[model samples]
Target: MTETTPAQLIARSNRLGADPKNTNYAGGNTSAKGTEIDPVTGTPVELLWVKGSGGDLGTLQESGLAVLRLDRMRALVDVYPGLEREDEMVAAFDYCLHGKGGAAPSIDTAMHGLVDAAHVDHLHPDSGIAIATAVDGEALTSRIFGDKVVWVPWRRPGFQLGLDIAQIKAANPQAVGCILGGHGITAWGETSEESEANSLWIIDTAQAYIDEHGVDEPFGAVRPGYEPLPVDARLERAAALAPTIRGIASTDSPMVGHFTDSEEVLEFLASEKAPALAALGTSCPDHFLRTKVKPLILDLPATASVEEQIARLHELHAEYRADYQAYYEAHATAESPAIRGADPLIVLIPGVGMFSYGANKQTARVAGEFYVNAINVMRGAEALSSYQPISDAEKFRIEYWALEEAKLQRMPKPKSHQGRIAFVTGAASGIGKAIATRLAAEGACVIVADLDLEKAAAAAAELGGPDVAVGVAANVADAAAVQQALNDAVLSFGGVDLVVNNAGLSLSKPLLETTEQDWDLQHDVMAKGSFLVSKAAAKVLIEQRLGGDIVYISSKNSVFAGPNNIAYSATKADQAHQVRLLAVELGEHGIRVNGINPDGVVRGSGIFASGWGANRAATYGVKEEDLGQFYANRTILKREVVPENVADAVYVLTGPELSRTTGLHIPVDSGVAAAFLR
Candidate 1:
């Protein structure tokens, strides 16, 4: 065994994945260290680190590792001899994974300790996964590797896997390391040189076997699932998992194009009548944190609801967790707690795969690099044989490890929205301002549109710098002006997925005293403006083939019909009526329509100030300050209807949290029951 040179390491690392560009989740993790850098807060995290669970080990680093006290680990193992209860096992692993005890070893620590050698490395390399999990994996693998590496039956990782390897070691005290059946390979050496060489040789041989069989490339990888998070912070989260550098994320990060399966795979799937399932981040032992327990397979067509999708993902995770819990309950001591919260089941979205966080630049680069290559390998070998994963029972034991759960808890950023956009009409102040600010905070590029150009400009300035929020000047009621804003949105940010239509004016007058001019003034801005904005969104959303979300700022008076405000009430209904029809027409195009029926907004700082509210209260025998609050607190929930309430509703509509319901109007009237309590 010889020593590996740095140049040799770098060259090998570059070849570890596709999109060797220093980006997270582009294709997969890079094996290179220290390439990711934080774009915001301008702080640098680790550059090189060990890859997460089942990550492309080809792109690994020392910092990414969950360094643990090996002595402490052995102590925990002794206490729980059976370690069978899934929850108990998970609790143990989570506690240990945090390795907060100065030596937080990886969840795979035990296996690394057992099967690993002077230089030990394991990976669920794409090529190996395909042949190993196939119908004829045993025969195919046997035919390819011949006598180079020994093969054993599939077994769960940890003590049992360690035992299996130990047995193999026992039989041939001097024999080379063995590969786990239906899983991945572990290359060990007397020295790092021998280990890396063995690993490369196995990878090459596996690639040759796959190429000979003419398997197609990995197809239909869709990362559609998104969790809302801060844009700059998301970039920072990406940076932390790296070895040395940081990452500069953009609005474009969420705009990755979708990829469907090839004709061959599509045909195969249709004929079999089975929904397509993806093997997440290498499967089994790597299943817990990085890619979760399962990948988000779209079941051939797209899953309908975001909530439903989230439900399905959680259900799958719950099933895996339950099965784990049952196993431990049945087999081990009853005192252990479940490790890692339910949140740790981080499933990779079908279209949007897993991302990276490393200690140094090299580590992050390598993690992304490795995933890109591994995914390709998984796809390429599909035609040759199916990549069936290890049984769930075995997967639970490894996943529930206390050490692994601990590592997950410390993840810098666990949620993000990658491919969505938002717009806020009258985004200069109050409700509109709040809505735009919230969406931008959660990683959506907000187009702050207002007729008052100066106000919009000032609002954008407050958001600081370019990208998070951009001010657009246009009158929502004017067809041409509305269109120019739409065009600007398309050109500047690809397309819009979210719009909070908050541009409107309010007035107070008795119904008998109302005239044509006051009525038109209200209708032109609120009702017509809402329709024009929706109209523009429909065309762009349909063209882009991406779904859209629209949030109308309808007033609570639309339903409640408060005293002395007939025109405001009428226009609010008109604006909301447009949303229902809009839903019918745009549903097929993937656009959702929703509205917020906000009540008595006292901070009415948009186009029209709350001067109307103050005057109305004086005329109605109440204090100006008490009118808004008085009306709001009369509700069942007894909460004040503030700008924040309206803003929250808009935020929910424009994000993945409410991606399922369209054409639905939510009342931000502090939970007032629609009917009176007689």
Candidate 2:
């Protein structure tokens, strides 16, 4: 095997997956031919180890390698004549598997098995595809690489294509690799190192040719000062556009919108030729599975007001959907699957850059990343020559392939809160962060809104990446700030499914000692803050026509007034009454407003850290260390109430289990008799 081991094969495959220029996420495959001891025969049998179906080359593992009997696989070529159907050919390949531990063999296993080399690699490199998918691709390939490379015209990846590749390789013994017109390139050698070297050489060679001969265009129009616009300004605009896009992009499944403004995205958007360039299809045909044939483009003026922009976006979105439906109807066949949803996955805005739409944040961000790389490659191709991608017919075949459709339909059921977005005020730390993490664990994308922007970012990072949890800074008490925070959530995550009004501060002063500022602070956050968030979120939920939740985190003091805590107790009482009123007003719209009363959640809570625990202990003539036990003893259940206890209650209220229950108070205080709902 020329010193090529399984570990080396895996390393090389991972290297290919890790580089976006070489492979787009899970788009490529690699294989190695070796021998393994057969369990039945106890003899060394020839085998082919190919990357498993749906596996990413960047994070490949040995276990991810599908082992197939080489002799049996080779024999399929002879029997393949009668198997005209793709499924029949696929079945024969599956029958050739040697074991059941690994994943299914890659879809390109037939092509890999036909190559008479120890190591084989098929990669969708950006530079190579730019030339391969061009109008004069075959001629350009001959002129650029000459004898070193062979050319294969476009064909669906199946038995026929594999047979063609095998025949071409046999005919061109001097060739090191072959470029599949409008697809990608394949490289093979006696060793993994040699195969990888050949692939790199081909990519580098193509890139160098473009660097030398491609027409370089001045990328984007620059302002007088050349300094980019403030990030906050872009974010503001992106937020304003989020709800409109979300409303327009709704389909069979809810889609989360992720906004991105990377340097590449900005530069591409700023170019004078952006609209024409964007009209060209994806650089690689496989990207159709992620981004579709092309993105929906919009021209967003810098001077447009939020309302005006949203109105324009809504109108454009309707037109985009109509166009998508027309495209579907034009090419659909009897055997083709039902028309897929009309929502465009990628939306490009001139000033706002790009927004990738998906069922959740992870998928959205992945689409964004793919488009960024696509933009870079297409820019180079545009400067060099016309960026000619595959036709709509080819895209339709790949996008709705029966095998892919079946696989996608059989995908595991999503979690309870999949595609759901949640907003949690004061989520930077303590009870808010705990609740946010809990929501994410159940598959909800959470917006961590906090007064301290830095802390909010840190908390979001701690929970997960920006895709799972995003941070927005705002004073919940400020009306304008609350509205902005609501906008932030919608923009970052498309829409809000659950809103947690958990932002509160403790003021533990006697009635005579309490100042006007302290009273206003407590009321502003607990009562006014909850009102503003609920009002804005309710509007969004109504527009979405999807049922949603509004959860108010009230204190036990709302029921039984505590000594020297008039501001905290009175504000919490107001919050409880507001929840009932909101529940009455919003119930008609299918938006549930509920309240959770948690008592003495002293452990790891923001109020505890802000001296509430010490103040309570001092008032009760006990040390702070004994505060938790003191509260525990006071409750009938005699269990100390923690943040998670409150979070669990929130989950129940927000989830479908309690869907029929609204306008009610749920106690999460280990059975506090005085705080019990009467």
Which residue window of length 10 is worst by lDDT in model 2? 220-229
Question: Which regions of candidate 2 deviate over 4 angstroms?
Answer: 2-4, 81-83, 218-232, 299-305, 451-455, 472-474, 478-495, 531-547, 584-590, 618-626, 629-638, 659-662
- Give the RMSD in angstroms, all C-alphas superposed, for model 1: 13.8
Position 69, candidate 2: lDDT: 88
| Residues 190-212, model 2: lDDT tens digits | 88889999999999898898888
Please provide TM-scores, in order, for all candidate models, with all chains considered together. Answer: 0.47, 0.91
Error of 2 at 364 (Å): 0.8
> How many angstroms is residue 251 displaced in model 2 relative to the true structure, after the best TM-score fit?
3.6
- The top-ranked prediction according to TM-score is 2
Task: List ranges where model 1 is wrong by over 4 Å.
Answer: 1-64, 69-104, 166-178, 189-200, 215-382, 385-433, 439-500, 504-525, 529-678
**Winning model by lDDT:** 2
Q: Which ten residues in a row have the lowest lDDT in candidate 1?
A: 242-251
Whole-model lDDT per candidate: 0.55, 0.82
